[model samples]
Target: MRAIVVSEPGGPEVLEWREVPEPRPTRGEVLIEVTAAGVNRADLMQRQGLYPPPPGVSEIPGLECSGVVAEVGEDVEGFAPGDEVCALLAGGGYAERVAVPWEQVLPAPSGVTLAEAAGLPEVVCTVWSNVFMAGRLRRGETLLVHGGASGIGTCAIQMAKAFGSRVVVTAGTPEKIAYCLELGADEAINHREEDFAEKVTADVILDIMGAKYLGRNVSALNTGGRLVVIGLQGGLRGELDLGALMARRGSIISTGLRNRPVADKGVIVRGVLENVWPLVAAGAVLPIVHEVVPMADAARAHRILESGDHIGKVLLAR
Candidate 1:
């Protein structure tokens, strides 16, 4: 099997395509013939030596993929060879084949293409767990999402709206903001030109910029607001006004999917499959794919994700 491997930390150029042994399914796992994999910020961070795979996991960088099952291991049931599925991988997705836990795999929604389904797992699990489960965004509440044109951002915007929440978003430019609005954001602000804290009212904030937006996020929140920081695209350190948080009775939460216990991710995967898969199959929620590059061009896919110009998910097709 051909896989993308990084021998040393660097840039996208560090990704090397080479032949590697095919992975076999272990107990409760399934071997998949990879069809496509989603490119994520975590992959770039791993390439740059900022993030490492969890202990006992594959060192490959990809985090989500869609494919057909090749074989099922002992204790794995309800899935068989030739089943069309997409999975949230902890690691090792940038290959022609991978072994994924059965708990992390879900049947691909009808009407979704294999390449597009590759883009679903990470964003879906992240948004549902953080925004709805953790952040407690509720109907009629105002929700703000940073990086509105991003894969997670787009998914968050749609799901929040679909659940009757008023969604607002911030993006780098007017074009990106417009794209966010097109994807169901009720309000879209150009972070480059506008002070979102002063212009918009938010009951909950789904932030990707972390330190860069911390102060403004605190200022923008309504009373009892929940602020969930999921990424650190900007610098990771910044000043926070504890006074503002206390006055508003706001709460701050942060989490990352990678490096978490497999049991925890498995629970999230099962919850998402039960709660959100119906929305996907019904065409109410969809994976937004910006580009699809061949697996051998994994370096190009990484470049596109790191460029910050893509409006949605970038996929590497096997």
Candidate 2:
């Protein structure tokens, strides 16, 4: 087996595809012969030595993958060999094979190819958990999304729209803003020129710009609003306006999926399969893929993502 190894963690150049021992399924897990993997911001962070994998997990820097099930571990049910599936992983997605807990695995969405399904797990789970489950975004309410051109952003826009929520998004350029609107966002704000806080108030704000947008995110919230921060693209430290937050009865939460327990991820995956996957199958929600690069060109994929030029996910395919 071969996987992308971040040798000494610095830049995209640090990633090296090299031979490694193949992984086998353990109890309650399954082995997937990787076909495609989703490249994410977290993978970049890991390459830069910022976000290390949780203890006892793989060092390969990928978080989601789609492949054919090669073997099923003991105690696993409802899945069998040769099933086409996609899975959320703690790590090790940038490889020819990955062993994942059965709970983290899901049947490929009906309308999408197995390769494109690689892009769905992380973004779908993130949006479903943060926007609906944790942030409590309800139908007929307004939801705000940061980085609307991103993999998470694109998925969030469609899912929120499918559930009848008004979606507003922020992006860096005019083209990106237009793309977001095309993907069902009711309004698109160019962050480079406009202050999003002055334009609209939201019932739920899904934020990726942490410190830079913290104060304004609070101001942009409607009464009893929920703000969920899942990325720190801006910075980590930010001062909170407790007075304003208290007055509005707003709540702020920061979460990460990679470090969460397998049991928790299973629950989120189950929710996604039942709720979000249907939207995807029905064409109400779709996986937005920017480009598909070969696994050996993983370094170039990282560069494209870091450049922030792509509109959606850059997938690495076998």
Candidate 3:
């Protein structure tokens, strides 16, 4: 099998296409013949030596993939060989094969192509866990999403809207703002030009570009609001006003999917399958794919992801 292997920590140029041994499924896991893998911001972080794979996980950078099940492990039920599946991974998605825990897998949504399904797992799990389980976003509440045109942002917008929340988003450009609105955001603010804190009102904030939005995000929240920070695109260090949070009874929670215990991710995957996958199948939520590149062009895929101009997920096809 040919896989994208990083020779060293550096730019996308360090990613090399090489022949590697095919992986086999272990107990409670499944070996998937990778059809497509989603490119995420975490992948870029890994390439830059910022995020390392969790202990015992593959060194490859990918975090999510969609493909057909080649084999199933012992005691794994509800799935079989040849089943179309998409899975969340701790790592190793940038290959032709990936062995993923059965609990982290979900049946591909009806009417979605294999390429598009590759973009589902990470965003779905991330949004569901943060927005609902942790953040407690509820019906009729105002929700704000940072990086509105991103894969997770787009998914969050649709899911929040589906759950009856009024969604607002922030993006870098006019085009991205329009795209977010089309994806169901009630209001879209161009973060590059406008002060999003003044333009939108929110009871819950789902943030990706963390420190950069820290002050404004706190200011934008309504009383007793919750803010969930999932990424640190604009550097991790920032200044905050404790007085504002104390006065408003505001709370800030930060989390990441990678490096978490497999058991915890398995639980998140199960919840997502039960709560979010159905919405995807019903067309209430859909994967947004910005582009599909061949697996051999993994470097190009990484470059595209780093450019930050893409409006949705970038997939690498095997």
Segments of candidate 2 deviating more than 4 angstroms: none
Q: Hey, what RMSD does candidate 1 come out at?
A: 1.0
- Quote the positional error of residue 208 for candidate 2 in Å: 0.4
Q: Per-residue CA lDDT of candidate 2, range 1-318, in tens?
A: 999988897999999999998998989999999999999999999999999999999999899999999999999977999999999999999999999999999998899999999999999999999999999999999999999999999999999999999999999998999999888899999999999999999999999999999999999999999999999888999999999999899999989898899999999999999999988889998889999999989999999999999998999999
Answer with 2 or 3, whichever has the higher lDDT.
Answer: 2
lDDT of 1 by residue, 1-318 (tens): 889999799988889999888888999999999999999999998999999998899998899999999999999978999999999999999999999889889898776897799999999999988999899889999999988899999999888888899999989977898889888899898888889999987888999889988999999999999999999987799899999999999999998887777788888988898888888888878998899999888999988887888999999997
Q: Write candidate 3's Cα lDDT for 1-318 as tens digits.
A: 889998999999999989988888999999999999999988988998988998888988799999999999997878999999999999999999999989889898886898799999999999999999899999999999988999999999999999999998888888898899888899988877889988876899998777888998999989999999998877799999999988889999998888777789989988988888788889999999899999889999999988889988999997
Please, what is the TM-score per model?
0.98, 0.99, 0.97
Q: Please list the C-alpha lDDT of all candidates, in the order they appear.
A: 0.90, 0.95, 0.91
Best of the candidates, TM-score: 2
Among all windows of 10 consecutive residues in model 3, the one with the lowest summed lDDT is 254-263
Q: What is the clash count of model 1?
A: 0
What's the number of clashes in each of the models?
Answer: 0, 0, 0
lDDT of model 2 at position 80 = 96
Report the Cα lDDT for residue 33, model 3.
92
